[model samples]
Target: MVKSAGYKMVGGNGVFFPILGFASIIAFIYLSFGDLLSVRYKNEINLSFVERNGTNFVVDGKLFYINGWNSYWFMDHAVHVDSRPRIRAMLQAAAKMGLTVCRSWAFNDGDYNALQITPGQFDENTFKALDYVIAEAREVGIRLLLSLVNNLDAYGGKTQYVKWAWTEGVGLSPSNDSFFYDPSIRIYFKNYVKTILTRKNTITGLQYRDDPTIFGWELINEPRCITDPSGDTLQDWIEELSAFIKTVDNKHLLTVGLEGFYGRKSPKRKTVNPEFWAADMGVDFIRNSAPSAIDFASVHIYPDQWFKRKSLKGKLKFVADWMHSHIEDAEQVLNKPVMFTEFGLSDLNKGFDPSQRDEFYKVVFDVIYESAKKKGGGGGSFAWQYLVEGMEEFNDDFGIVPWKRPEMYRIINQHTCRLAKIHGAYKPVTGNMNRICNGRW
Candidate 1:
């Protein structure tokens, strides 16, 4: 009847024109939007998945669990240039696996380079890349917990970045307090919300706090301030940022980036980089550090690959138990639902010995599902990555992309519906931990 978003009409062949138009729409959807129909979302979660009561994510009258895998950073990068095919394949695979969500870092590796001209600028291309992903995933039936801003990997997570990031918390400095509280940052932040919310693609629906496709909008990836552990100032920054996002796009829940908690005997809250403190620093910490920030909580784990690894496969259940205990603690502390935004182990046998990857996957699934089933229940997770091709030897090869390491695929399949007849036994109790700091994810 009418054409907007660019449409032209040829009235002479109106009869056949409608047929052709309908067919084209069908083809486009079949090729890309098929999952919108095939997949189902039990429900979009509230900002409670990061909370804790007796268990984790026991908020908003829902269990709020997440079943996902990761992809390399999407925003502020050149996916159209680097890993297009892999992106498609990865999303397609997860759709088959019954995965409901996927997560990615949203900032450029240079988001903080003097705030000058040479880098980290947010623009059309960045939005375009993200637009592509939302479309692709929708076609395959997956939701997203896209985290904004990644100061942690500002320099590709170099040694110095790690040192500076940890010592100062990945947040902006007091001298640079204006960066967080500045009107400019707020404008850019709101622009980001507008970019995702207003730009409605077949997949990128209104980024409401409850849109299935837009599972959650997160603030910063693995944020850690350089100041106090109780980083009140940093937490205040989160509060302000959360308000900005909700004011514009109240359709979606918000979340603060977090790491799963620590164990009783775990090494001092340090990092694999030896520079920053692991995301979980304070005692039973969760959003207690960034309270009043978002609706959900998020964390990452690469213990086997980055930390000490005694025997992940053999201690699979133990590993699951640890995650359960830690996440539960987080929920209690933060009072929100949670998502294990990143968790991976390589079988490379280099630093921590790669043979442990498989078991790590099993443990991850067990921990996640078990966490979801219990009282508080689980939220979600994004395996380290998908399609980490040319990026091999780049940094952390966390892709579920099938290339050098076939194990990534195997492990993915093990937990996915493609081969769901089998299942891991020691499901963790992580979800029973608790809920949020008022953010989303």
Candidate 2:
């Protein structure tokens, strides 16, 4: 349930007057005196669990916009005592930049330091590391969006799940896609889900389902089933797992973590796809996201990877069109919010320049900002990834270390402040709200 943030004015003579007419005056006072209020009453106005309200997210009856970034390595780093500080640093940096959400992996299956050593077995030490991540993030007032698994092979993905099933002597199809169809594999995955949802955090002593620190649960990262281009295989998998997850823990939001490709069912929408082959990726943005248990839509943008042959200008155009199409579909067709869950321009591309990357980010941010201004289904985004300094081992072509990139940092900070203003929840930082709103921070 959403609580109202409305304020009232009472007179000494037992008379009352509506304060709605003086909104501008009240806003000025709040902004100017925010430092005083922040220390004393900020906790009183703190929002609880994020909730879906049509095409927007709300908390305490106020719109909650997502201006976030991904740090998939949080749990991986949190496991080591020395490296654990990095997770805290990253979250602190994100809070200073005004980011509200973080997307990271919750499942690391069958590998060194794996969260799940096998189908139902988990490492207690690794689970504690994840507990630390949640505890720290909560302190900074950031919510987490944790993915249950990965579609790719990195960090023990579907391949790991398939390998576990094979070792268990479950006679199944040789295809890795069987992870979605085979009954035994399905039960194994469900057991993992139930375990995660029911487990209590060691640090906070809060059951995973009851903690408002979690923004949502992503079923999988960039799920695709090329073996079944008809999309029925993936659609069925999403429906079943999404329903199962809801039954176990309905407090948090849930998304499919799709790359937002159009399939055979969306003939006209296919035109906006990056390539002809995208239509056969076995996951339709509309159909997969249409399940009753699925709360919103997820899309990932990687023009550099998708269209390696295109010039920078050509790639930028595709980025704009790709995002615009998905936003429109979310608003008009699905009537659900859509997040650009992952997007970045790789510096490794030939002839790549920081300027080019900046341009790409601007286009993506512009599309989201425009849609958000109109209260459309564009729910905001998380840049491909963020990293703290000295974490070079985890660095990829898309990794963003804000301190080292001043221009990119400014762009992200400006976007955060703009969205906060739109939500009417902007608070002054040390009584310098004007400076922050002007992007001077």
Candidate 3:
């Protein structure tokens, strides 16, 4: 999951072009045609919604691999006119880096600038803010994986839902985990899901359910039901909600945003968990993902947070094993594509080094690349969080500012180029194609 904070910004920078030399004329002609071809090529590809084809995402008859990031604050930033430019900058930078997907929060319930003011009530202005996000993302050809709700308390998550239930005198239990078992809360959530799906984007005049720019819908972010360690409660909730989502919007894909924790059913796999207590989180990755309504599997990695005592070297080794084990399971046992939706090493750790984070990113990317090369179930990955300059107030320990961190920027760009090449979707820009792919600015 991603940490949330606030931001404030307004103006954007300008782009300048130098005068062309004699040799530049020929290059200009070539690039002009390249741009035309690129536009036409993308149009054809975008005509079809991304679909899962036996462990691989297919778009217009070609395999699609994701290289993406998370900006959970997009909707928040887009809500205000003064801060709207930040959303554009973030998406523009993502496209320039060759990122294809972005996972962000689609729901912000009962908070400042909230989308859903009450269970069924919504703020039109806030909803339009999300419309702006989807519009801008479509303009840049970036797909969105919008999470419906959060498990953590940050953005009026399950806690807020339970609060609403209690306030209405229909809550099943005082515990926050009652969000999974309360029928009243369940109805409230399903209503919100339908509202979002049927919402027509004011900017593009397209309902979200019919928009291809949306990659899929995540049922919840990092779900955990501690009340029932047997995992049955969470399993039933997932089945009910997933089925409900599919009934409303069968065109798009769906996933249960699990942290890939092994549960009581998978006793042997529990050894690979970060700690013994992880298995009791009431989330069995395989069982939760096995529902017919769920399209793929989602996992998050945060070695820096999960195992603080381990040295950077130790964490790197664990990263390899953890990713490999999940990828193997998704391929063999589940026969579904698995995505590393969130992964990062925080700078706040004791004895932290930027090099360690860089290496951590490389390891995660390498594993995904290797799996993609073999046509395995490793779909792709999304780094924890992405922010731009002037958004320092919103920065968390895992936030990534590409311009400020050139090394990390290059690492991500190289991965995007390699993945683009694998799908034969690499489009030539006017200059420095080799440098861009080679990670040299």
Candidate 4:
């Protein structure tokens, strides 16, 4: 009552009316655009097998590629992740660096999904950044590979649901509770995409296979089992989902973002990514089981080279070799393009240790050379980030720019990673007699 009286004392509808109207506009954006935002890419996609004699990633007779990182443009994550004005800065930076693509993460974790924090409610302002990004990236000669749902626990991890479970009667079968099985999730995602494409510009086009603005669709951000079994083991759901995506947005490419599962696993760690069991980083999963619904694959590498300081970190060096060999294995098996979406040191402290930075640099250079030049998969790497200053602000230490920690520029932009080698290489694919066993084709 006191608040109402105070406003009434002003006795001015002129001031209050504008405030209410602005509030209404923001509310409308939330309900329609921001809350259920998704990539504006089309669903229908027609993919033809792309093969190169050497390590190269040419899609549909086009030598397409990118050199970039994962970052929120101008938006701060403590509240906002997209800021169009800040994105303008990112575009300037990206163009200067010759970066062709970026991998932005949209986390749909526990708080966002179940709406535990808001109950199926989402931040409407959050999506504005993405729309701006799509437009800016295109203007600056960069393409986007938007990671729709994030890797963080919001999208419904196994045990993170607070005694609530996603898998119930019929494993991963259609259910409201199941992350993949729920129709509501898709509905929300579809709306997210609609807002992004429709709000900004109709000429933007579908980003995936057909969209001129987007290069591809990464299904999940390093999707894996953090605590329990992934709700849907039956890929029929995934295949069907892919079909659905194809129907609505036909202008883009699609792929599952299961980072190097087998390669990162350690006899040393004992616990493998849950996806390892479902679809390991090697041939077995890449070929068919885990993600037959889409085209292409991806992985990340962040060996402990910077921490251990040992020659190859005693075990870290083996990762590049393992990844290289596996890339070949993936090509022979999956017959699709591949990209190393993330790689680099975890530490952001400028004065941590120079040797660590040097070692990290070598690992990155060597991996790109060996993998893209010699290995079969040979897509490329999008270093973990470009300018994630926020992580440093909280002392999180996982960034390359903003912090400007000497190592950030040293490792990624020191010409350590060759663009031609990383972006202009090709590899050959070898096929076997029985790709379709027992009429499974």
RMSD of each: 13.5, 13.2, 7.3, 14.5
Per-model clash counts, in order, read: 72, 0, 0, 41
TM match of model 4 to true structure: 0.62
Q: Model 3 compared with the native: what TM-score? A: 0.88
The order by descending lDDT is 3, 2, 1, 4
lDDT of 2: 0.79
Decide which is better by lDDT, 2 or 3. Answer: 3
Tell me each candidate's TM-score: 0.63, 0.87, 0.88, 0.62
lDDT per residue (tens digit) for residues 1-441 in model 1: 111111111111111111123343344436643644444322232222233333343334534455676664443233345334445545654554456577764444333221112222435555566666766555554567776655343423212223333354543433333344445455545565555555644334434344445666777655544434445545566777787776777656677665544322335334212123443232223433335546666666655433344555434654565566556654665556666777665545455544466667777777765555454535556777654333333234444444345675555544443212222211111121111101111
Worst 10 residues of 4 by lDDT: 1-10
lDDT of candidate 3 over 241-314, digit per residue (tens): 99999999999999999989899879645578887778888889889999899999999888877775778889
Whole-model lDDT values for every prediction: 0.48, 0.79, 0.80, 0.45
- State, as a TM-score between 0 and 1, how close model 1 is to the true structure: 0.63
Consecutive 10-residue window with the lowest summed lDDT within model 1: 432-441
Candidate 4 per-residue lDDT, tens place, 1-441, comes to 001110101011111111123343344334533522233334232333333333345656755444556653222232232322334444444544445567765433343312122223445544444444565555544567766554334243222322233332223433322444445445554554443333433334433334455666666655543222323332434466566666666556666666555422234112332223323322223432245447666766654422244344553555565466546655776666667776655453334664565576566556555554453455656765555222223122434552245554444543322544434421211111122111121
- Stretches of candidate 2 exceeding 4 Å from the true structure: 1-47, 426-441
Candidate 4 Cα outliers beyond 4 Å, as residue runs: 1-56, 59-62, 72-85, 107-124, 154-177, 181-210, 226-237, 263-292, 305-312, 348-354, 374-376, 388-391, 402-411, 414-417, 421-441
As for model 4, its CA RMSD to the true structure in angstroms is 14.5
